[model samples]
Target: MFHTESDVVFVKGLTVEAVIGVYAWERAITQPLLIDIALETDISRAAISDNVNDALNYKAVCDDVSAWCQAIKAQLLEHLAGQIADKLLAKYSCHKITLSVAKPTASSKRIRLGCRSRVMQRSSKISQL
Candidate 1:
């Protein structure tokens, strides 16, 4: 599909509060996890209808991600990001997703650090559902 644009929707700079870190001081407080996600979806119906119901509702996706992020007590950014990717992939049935999470308030110099993960919906899992 060279030069062909895929129907992709994205959510960027979605800041969510979660307890994410490996340090003792970090465990005591909530930190903001900056998230960016791009999902590959079919938006043909939405394009024709101009209806949100026919589209991939991003507000709902944000809410879902927020809820999931806030549920953690203490964790690493890598695991947290992976969990987020898994939840979104299953709920939205997207064929592919690219997710990144960054902890901006991590260091004294504010050196933002985190990980990026990409996950695909397996054919077997989709069939099972």
Candidate 2:
């Protein structure tokens, strides 16, 4: 596999509220969500040019994620994570990305839920005859 160095872009502790779980009680109310995302891309151009356009605008990414989450409610954390990963891949052109979503305190007798997910993407090149 090939690897590329990104500009170390990340979004930490982005809090949001969503309904996610597998139990009846879990679905009854919304819960706080913490999201962390890391993107891998060559940011040299942006660094050299000193232009925001040349870099991956993290705010845009966050807005997109928030909107998508608000629009589509998921019953499981796995599904929610997958949705975010897929959306980022489709919306952004990057070599790799990792996303994690956590419920903080979902293990209580009242809550009883916890989930996290991570994904990575790689670039591929093929020889044309």
Candidate 3:
């Protein structure tokens, strides 16, 4: 039977500098964004095997996230968040993903995109590593 119980792997307070926003001034400069991510996956194999190869490689995820953030010229937090979710879900072996994105200098505290329950759909769109 498929395992029903799962574990959460998370990364918090990862700061990414990206050119995000729609305004003229906002588009002109890169801003620092705080990102938090949660991934749901079964790690029983890794736990039993005691091998890094058996586990989810968080370093790779962080590296890819940082690279995508830098490479994407997305204008909105929501859009970027969705793109990130879709990309990670497609690339990683996670069942679900949750993300929180915040502009430290923006008027509001944060913008949260809804959780993605499915992977690789690519309709639209981490971590403190």
Cα lDDT listed for each candidate: 0.83, 0.74, 0.77
Task: Identify the superior model by TM-score, candidate 1 or candidate 3.
Answer: 1
lDDT of 3 by residue, 1-129 (tens): 356676888988888888988899998999888888888888888888899999999888888888888788788877788778878888899878887777777766465432233332444312321
19-50 per-residue lDDT for model 2 (tens digits): 77778887788888788888776778877889
Off by over 4 Å in 2: 1-4, 109-116, 121-129
Better of 1 and 2 by lDDT: 1
Clashing pairs in 3: 12-128, 82-125, 83-125, 86-125
TM-score leader: 1
Candidate 2 vs candidate 3: the lDDT winner is: 3
Give the winner by lDDT.
Answer: 1
lDDT of 3 at 44: 87
Clashes of each: 0, 1, 4
User: In candidate 1, what are the lDDT values of residues 25-122, reduced to their tens digit?
Assistant: 87888888899999988777888889988899899999999999888554788777777888888899577889999989876796878899888854
Name model 1 segments beyond 4 Å from true: 1-5, 122-129
